[model samples]
Target: MPNKLEQLKKMTVVVADTGDIEAIKKYQPQDCTTNPSLILKAAGLPGYQNLLGEAKGWIKSGESADDVIDKLTVSIGTELTKIVPGYVSTEVDARLSFDKDAALARARHLIKLYEANGVGRERILIKLASTWEGIQAAEELKKDDIRSNMTLIFGLEQAIACAQAGAYLISPFVGRITDWYKKSTGTKDYPVDEDPGIQSVREIYRHFKAHGYETIIMGASFRSAAQVEALAGCDRLTVSPQLLGELEADEGNLKRQLTPTMGSDKEDKVSEAEYRWSLAEDAMAGEKLNEGIRSFHQDTQKLKDLLTGDQAQEKRAVAQTGA
Candidate 1:
């Protein structure tokens, strides 16, 4: 019997959800994703120092810290494209999540940077938060032939909006949903079948498949191997390095938990008003979306600080040497 990871790949695309190049090479996922948090973690690794230095060099060329960060992001993304045969999701600034024009501009810049680095827009998925503004930006981006991966999705409303907007992919965070439910209900254990996060993705999957939406559903942010196993037949699952190792070691029979189903329940497209109202009603989704944005923004700031500090040290060294 093949290990669980191998078996899962037969039915679903396994995406390495990290910035660790070494881990991506080991698991060999079909695609890979990295957010600000993952990229920050990768920035600290010794192997990525050259990438950091190159980004800092941009700062010396009079680019703002934000532009330098974008360059660093695409620099890492460019390397990943060499390894993965499929798309690499590079996120726009999280702070621009609510600004449609800014998000669109930044996404365009990122794509241009990738193209300059020899990776075309076809190989990249501009990751945007699943806010109303972000969805609007994605809608426009699609017309220009740029694919988008809608991140921070927590409800059916967000999923439906992304599908309606023609997003290329949607990442429904599984572990974070489970985390919210556990905290709210004060329950430590949720059976695999009854896990809130798993159930949420299953619901979104069934809806999309039944409605024949072209937007792909990729389950992400897994907390355990069991969560990964439960959603075995999803369109894709972006997993962390630790859980990937767990799945690679376990030679278990992975069953197909999700499959396509066509239904007669056609629904109207979700308008912006309806989308916002529905999201507001879902307390868990609303809270988690806000938390996810704040967390990503904080990590992005941390990355800027790291780059600025390095630049300051270099300046001091130059002055001391009288060069």
Candidate 2:
């Protein structure tokens, strides 16, 4: 019998969800996804110095902060694209979530940056937070030939909206949902199969398959090995390095639970309004989605600060050179 990882791989695409280039090179995931938080973490790491230095050098060239940041993001994305045979996800500014027009504009810019850097649009999925406004933006972007990844999706309403918007993909945040339940219950003891996050993704998988929605669902933000294991049959799962290592090292049995045929067989009838109301009732999901966007927006600001600081220093250096 093959190993559990092998069995899981047979069922779904395993993606490395990190900005850590070393981890991506080690795991050799089929694809990778990075957000502002992950990219900020990577920027602070000693190992990623070269990537940051490259970005700073561009800043010294009188490029605007936004241009420099996009270059930095695309540099990381291009590196990941080269390593992974599949597409890489690069996010748009989270601060632009409520602005449909701005979100689409930013997305097109990101895709253009990627293409200019030698990465085709086909290999890049612009990640946007799945707010109502964000979904609206995606709907228009799809018409313009720009594919998207709707992130921070917790409740089924977000999923259904993404499907209706004709998004290319949606990343349901499994671990964050699990975190909410664990904190609310004040207990760490949770069953893998019965986990709320796991169940959420399962319902979504079934719904999408049953409705014949072409939008792909990828489980994101896993907290543990069990969470990843429980979601074996998902279309894709973006995992952290620590969790991926745990899965790769474990000798225990792993089961593949989700499948397209199984999903097609498991159907549920829930209207969009009902789904939205139910999602609104879930206080945790509502709060978390907002918090996630705020966090990303904060990071984007921090990145902007870094680029601005670099530019100021470069200007001082140029003055000294002329003086």
Best candidate, lDDT: 1
Worst 10-residue lDDT window, candidate 1: 314-323
In angstroms, the error of model 2 at 179 is 1.2
Q: Model 2 off-target regions past 4 Å?
A: 60-62, 263-279, 308-323
What's the residue-level lDDT of 167 in candidate 2? 94
lDDT of 1 by residue, 83-157 (tens): 999999999999999999999999999999999999999999999999999999999999999999999999888
Best by TM-score: 1
True-vs-predicted CA distance for residue 175, candidate 1, Å: 0.7
lDDT of 2 by residue, 1-323 (tens): 66666667778898898878789888888889999877767776677678888877787788877778777888888878878899899998888888999988889999888889888988988899988888888889888788899999998777888898899999999888989988999978578878989999998998898788999999998878888998888999998889888877776777778877754454344455655675689897788899899988877666665556666753543333211
RMSD in Å for all candidates: 5.0, 5.9
